[model samples]
Structures are given as C-alpha cells and as structure tokens.
Target: MKKICLIASLITVFALSSASVNAQYYFFDGDYYENPVLYEAGVSVNAMNSLTDLGGKKGIGEKFLKDLNLGYTSISGGIFFSVSYKNAVALRLEGTFGKVSSDDKILAGINDAAKNRFNRNLNFRSNISEVAALVEIHPMYIFVDWPAKETTPPRTSPYLLAGVGYFSFNPQTKIGNRTIDLQPLSTEGQGFAEYPNRPIYKLNQLNIPMGAGVKYELSPLVNLRAEVVYRKLFTDYLDDLSTTYIDPALFDKYLTPQKAANAKILYDRQIVKVAGINGKRGTEKNNDAYFTANLKISVIIGRERIRR
Candidate 1:
C-alpha cells in the first residue's frame, strides 16, 4: 500500500508540473476565452456497513444482523486539480484515499473447530483501505457567478461526475491465535481442506465508480464539495463468507441417502448464511455492493487569459 501511495503522489506531482508549463502557452496567448485552474483538498466522513441476514435456513436473523453491524465512519482527504474552459465545461484530475471496515457479530458464531480450520477468530475487526481518481464536469455552473462584493458568500454549486478508477482492498478476519484471510472462503470447498492451518483468502478487486455532488465556493481560491459515489466491484467475495447447507432435494441429486445425511451433520455448523437482494436467504444471487460519500476542499491555482 505504501508503494502504491508513493506512485500516486508522483503521478499527481508530474501532472501538476506538466499542466503549469502548458497553461502559459494557452492562457498567455489569449487562445482560450475562460480558464480557471483549481486545486482542492478536504476530508470526508464515511458511514460504511452491510445489511445483515442477506440469505438461508437457520441463518442469522435479519434484525439481529443489522443491529450487530460494525464498520468505520472515517475521515478521508484528497487533492484535486482541474481547469475550466470557456466557463461552460471543465476537466478535473483527482485522487482520494481512505480507510473503511466491516465488523459484525455474525462472526461470533464460528466454533473453535471452525476457527482453527479456517485460521480466523471470527470476531468483528477493522481491516480495509481504498483509493480512487475521478474526472468531473461542471455544467450548471455556467450560469452562476461568484459574489465579489457580498460579505457572505453563496454556498452551493451542483455538478455531476462519472469515471473509471483502479482500487485495492485487503479484508481480514481473526480466528484464534492468528488472523486469517476471508476472501477465499467463498471457494473453500474446492481445495481448502488441504491447508487447514493457513489463512484461506487473498481477495482483491477493481472498482467502477460513478456519482454526483454539490460544491460551495468558500472564496475565489478555495471551495468545498460533498459527493456520494457507488462502487461496482468485479468480485462476489467481499464478505468472505458463504452459506452452503445441503437441502434434502439438493442432496438427493448429488449424494447417496446415507452420505447426504452425514453431509448435513458436517455442514450444520459450517455454512455462513447470506441474505439475498429480496431480504430472503437461499435465493438465486449471493453478491454484495459498496457505497461511499466524500467531502473535499479545493483551491484555485491560477486564472487569467493573456493577450496574444
């Protein structure tokens, strides 16, 4: 993570330096009618958690799961540099980083044997990180003007943004004497039994980001922004858990009657129930979603058009 952060910082610095050199050619030559350079930094509070009892038979109750929710409301900060052209359009480069967690009492049900087998404690704990970049457009701001004479300034400017970003996440769970990886729990049945003493998962994913927000200009050079974004991930194992109990009919198809009965006992305490989209367990789907809200402050670096 530190290496990734260092690389991001270098990229941002290079971009700003390159932009500064290019700005003189466009602005000094009077080739553009309007050009406003902006730089911003701010912090955000993230209320991130999951809905419980998402899908199963003999699963955690919906209300109990919801109430046992655990996660972090963290303050994330970022820096953005952008340029507005002709007052009608703009382009921005932004990088944001924050910490998020998924802790819940649902982990408490795992027995000592299960914990030893999976190498995780199953207790609620904070363990995750996030980073993203976005390209934004300021459409409605074309009609709004900054107040130059007012003692109190206007506090809002609505805008919309859509873009793609790369993300890296590390989710972990505690078992007994050691902390184990949970992302692999989804596919544990395949080859996990062989490695009973090691961490089971190393889950990582790429995220697709999109959202909208409003900005308030605090001064000619500084502004505040509040935005909400939904991230669509390419993986289905964010929770690093699963519920795979065998139904009589399901077992009848794959196992002999005697084997089926034994399998029930083996899985009785092994499966982790996940609620479906419709609030019922054992439905067709078994995936989850992630969302976030960010607040930021930015500064205007330079804004002036020179005569050719």
Candidate 2:
C-alpha cells in the first residue's frame, strides 16, 4: 500500500508539471513592468468651417455632413507632437493654421431663411492660427494579432480628446477691387460711445477643442489617423457679425472718408428692408464655433515595453 501511494503521488506531480509547461499565459501579472516613453510626430491636412449667426437655416442646427452645405469649407494644415504610455494615454501638442468664412449670399433659393439672411447680407473671412495642449484617452484595446507581442501594441485604436487653446484671427472681406479688414470698422456698433454696451473685441481669444478619432497602423513604423474636432468659442464676432446695425453715419465718424463709404456698403448689403429703419443685424444669444476634419500620418519611435 505504501509503494502504491508513492507511485500515485509521482504520477500527479508529472501531470501538473506538463500542464504548466504547455498552458498559454499571455496576460500581464502583478510583477514589476516597465513602460518606456513612446513618441510620434505627424502632419495633418484638415478641412474647416464655422457656424455663426451669419449663415445656415433658421432652426435647430444640423451637425456633420448636413450642415456642410451651409458652411463654405476651406483647407488647412498643421503639425503635432505626441508622447504616449502603454498605448493607452497620450499628451499632444498641436499647432494648427486655417481659414474660415461664411456668406449669407449662398442661401439664395435654398430656403426662406435665405430671405432674412440675404437681406442681412453679412459675410466675412478670417485667418486663424492656434496652439493647444491636449490629453487623449483610448479605452478599448483592439488587437491586430491573436496574441499581443512583447514590445508591441494593437495596430488600431479609437480615442477622445479635450483641451483649451489660444487663437488669433483677422477678419477680412473682398470689396470688389479692394479688400476690407472688418474688425476696425466695428460694423455692428461695436466701440461706439452711443452704443456704450458694445465693447471693442480683441483679435486673440480662448477656444475649447473637443473631438474623437480612430487610428490604424499602416506599417510597423507608420500610422494613419482620421479625426473630426470642433472648437467652441466665447466670442460671437469671428465672422464680424454679432449685433444690431449702427446708423450708417457712424462709419463716417470712425473711419477715413474713403473707408467710411466702403464700410457702409459692406455693413448693410440688404437687397430689401424698410427704407428708413436699420434693424437688428445679428443675435448675440449664442457664440460662434468651428469644426475640422483631419487626415494625419505619423511615424512611431520609442523604447520597447518590458515586463519581467
């Protein structure tokens, strides 16, 4: 009986040892793991547009492609710097340069909203540039391989980002053979002692950027990204239209004789209105916002992740 017991114990030990050697264990354990710095630098091309009181139909604003027709889309480009950890979190420094514009004239024959907008006939173009610092979170770990490899992560990921930035803009418009800078003119009664309520607006302001995106590894060292981001602004004058029309004469008081005439013509292009009355030109209830669709390519370089 003693010999039989000894044989049984030996068989059990061998079986357990074989299983331990053959079994698969791919997940990380509580053991010390070292995550090293990973860096990526990239350039992007984006298409951008703005939503303001100047353009779009009078109703709940539609988003994405639905509102594309309302905005005059423009092209932009920028560079990005990134530092990532375990492929889960990233800090990005972004510098973007772009232009945005809106024209009420585009509304012609589109809807009744056009009539009011056409009569208002306000249009503007602004060159904008900004630098932002953002944090990104990627929640789901998607895999390109059945078992993740050491020093490698999933080939694709989706992430969300939010951050604040400072931006500068100069609004301008083409007045036939001439180009007019709109901010100095204060077309909507801004900076007038008579309309003391309207304060002069600054060219530099803050913006909050929020957005989501997906990334794919085109190769071991190269990645591709497509993202859509919207920047919320506190100022309504991005397009230089945010308040009531001032007496056209105010232009003469504030600008040169030649500039005064040009400002008056650009201020109120109303094809139709009560001849004697200057109406509320725009609403200040809501601030302006802009969105961008970006395509980016990046190269990944860094120390490999290690676990022991």
TM per candidate: 0.55, 0.79
Best by TM-score: 2
Top lDDT hit? 2
| Candidate 1 CA-lDDT value | 0.46
Lowest lDDT block of 10, candidate 2: 27-36
Regions of candidate 2 where Cα sits further than 4 Å from its true position: 1-35, 58-71, 141-152, 275-278, 303-308
lDDT of 2 at 91: 70
| Residue 253 local lDDT, model 1 | 45
lDDT of each: 0.46, 0.73
Residues 246-269, model 2: lDDT tens digits: 788888887888878877888878
**What is residue 1's positional error in candidate 2, in angstroms?**
87
